[model samples]
Target: MNSLVLFLLTVVAFGSCLKLPSSFKKCDRKTTDFNQCLSEAIYGALRILDKPLPSHGLPSLYGVEFPDVFTMGNSTYGLLQKFYQTRYIGLSKPENINAKLDFGPLTITLTIEATYSQLTVETEFEAQGTIVLLPVNVITPVVYTLVNPTYTFTFVLEEYEKGTTYFRVIDSKIDAQTQGLKFDYKGLFSNKVLNEEFNNAMDEKWRQIWILFKSFDEVLFAPLFGTIFNDFLKKVPAAELVDG
Candidate 1:
């Protein structure tokens, strides 16, 4: 899920009570070049995540945590994957990026496209049943990589009035592309040969496996990010974050 790291951009706005860090740039909506400025502002903010901004409700990018346990099963792959206690590293390293913000009559939409050459996710996992006829049963440290993966995310915002106008996420879409995928499980089938073979197959059939779980992004990630972003937006009115 290389695109998983990109969600930080969607949650960039902070509460009005918290001052924007000097290093953070603001792109006023009234500016003629606001679209490009917004993109640069977002790309620049990625570098600031090396440390947490507690007052601003932002966490460090080096180790963003996903604590809740979640499960997803696919009949096509015959695999049930469960994950919990997951943490991600290397989020601040997005490359070849393009972020665009569009303000419509009734919505503000943000679309971000970026490629991650290397993003690491460490998680405790349990896989029951087989994938593509391969037997598997594992509950161990799982480290996965999606080589040179590019992600696109679109967020639709709706304005509401609470004394002042504020924007909240009403819908979102997540998309990703990758050259290949690799998984390194510490103890799969309890045999070194079997583990290597399984990984080799994964590398070869990465796209198919990725597609098999594409629904997970829509079912889980989109809503999860929308909720987090909306929480932050709740405290910051639209007029405060961007000039109208």
Candidate 2:
């Protein structure tokens, strides 16, 4: 709803589009090939999401559906109309990716953008949307476009099994930037002037929301990959893949 939430969700929702990588060689060799391979593995994995994934019978890519109105953490926004056609779009491979070892941790950093994404809630009268924070229980279409988003995270393998791998996101940071934002509302409490005033007010105050977005959403989003990556690594450990 605000810049923080916009930035945080921007980073998170789109990440769901990625698929786990297939295989790797041996992990014993710590060489340039290892870093390059790991980087390419992540890139290839995310590139797979350029195609849609099935949801029941519908196609979804990083798709997310909220009830007509719902609350997540401290944010809430929804439309008066709910439809099955809503889907998430524009999740692509990050422009750059780097993966390496930091002593005992596996570190990865990715540069990404949501320039082509369309996140909006549609209704009969007005299809409103916002990348900024919205009021609780408000009736409005929602859209947020993040032009650039980057996340750097370090993972430590706390536990590893012969057939399973376990890791945790010990340290993480996000560098988020936006090209522009849009928030349009038309409903019960709207005088055209009042709506414009409110929207402008929110845009002016968005910076206050960044701190919360980073603290909360970072925790929510980063671990998602750890669980899945842990599984992937269990199947393809660096020791086994790094040509040792």
Candidate 3:
């Protein structure tokens, strides 16, 4: 009788230890890897922001000084310049990109080092300190929009994967308000002869910007984001992959 009781006790103990689902185990491991990959990728890409803007045929609409205010054909184009200079543009180049991942309590922090050039009137924007990850659900899809007068961009990610994933953007314009300007340019900068040229121009500008943003969806963020996600997956244990 005592032997039987001992056997039953051992069985109960083992069963209790096996209470967790296999999938849960796999997900826990995958989640850790995913967080690490995200940190690495963000750090690397943010590093690019530090580098000098490549001379990508972006004409240097030369003038006495950075225009206090200017119009692009019919669309007004000053707010973005002001915003870029004040918020996005950097004074120096980034020296390093650092990232940390917290698996116990999922979170990621990124830090960047930078420097500026005083001579060329050019600035290099770096990732500076760190960007933290609030709570995120890895399984669900997430959408982010980067909006500007020139473009209305959208980014969608289904799951963080290394290669097989999609990201896209769309450009659009706000209504009626074109920062007060007029012209008749088409294609790259549309200047159609609609009933309300000003309104139409503004709409067209927004539409064109969205289109441009969409075009860059695949080219700009895919490879960069993918590589980072992939690296993270690799860190996951084999046992976890099977269970997940």
Lowest-lDDT window of 10 residues in candidate 2? 52-61
Stretches > 4 Å off in candidate 1: 1-16, 72-80, 129-137
Q: After superposition, how far is residue 81 of candidate 1 from its true place, in Å?
A: 3.5
Q: What is the C-alpha lDDT of each candidate?
A: 0.73, 0.43, 0.29
lDDT of 2 by residue, 164-201 (tens): 23233344444344434344444424567877776676
Query: For residues 160-229, what per-residue lDDT tens digits would candidate 3 score against the true structure?
Result: 2222222121221111111222221222112234324634555446555545434433444334333433
Model 1, range 81-188, lDDT digits (tens) per residue? 888887767766787668888878978898988678877678898888886687777788888787787778788999886545777899988887777678887777
Error of 2 at 196 (Å): 4.1
lDDT: worst 10-residue window of model 3: 56-65
Clashing pairs in 1: none
In angstroms, the error of model 1 at 20 is: 2.2
Query: Which structure is stronger by lDDT: 1 or 2?
Result: 1
Model 1's alpha-carbon lDDT is 0.73
Best by lDDT: 1
Off by over 4 Å in 2: 1-29, 51-91, 103-137, 163-189, 234-241
Q: Judge candidate 3 at residue 181 and give its lDDT.
A: 22
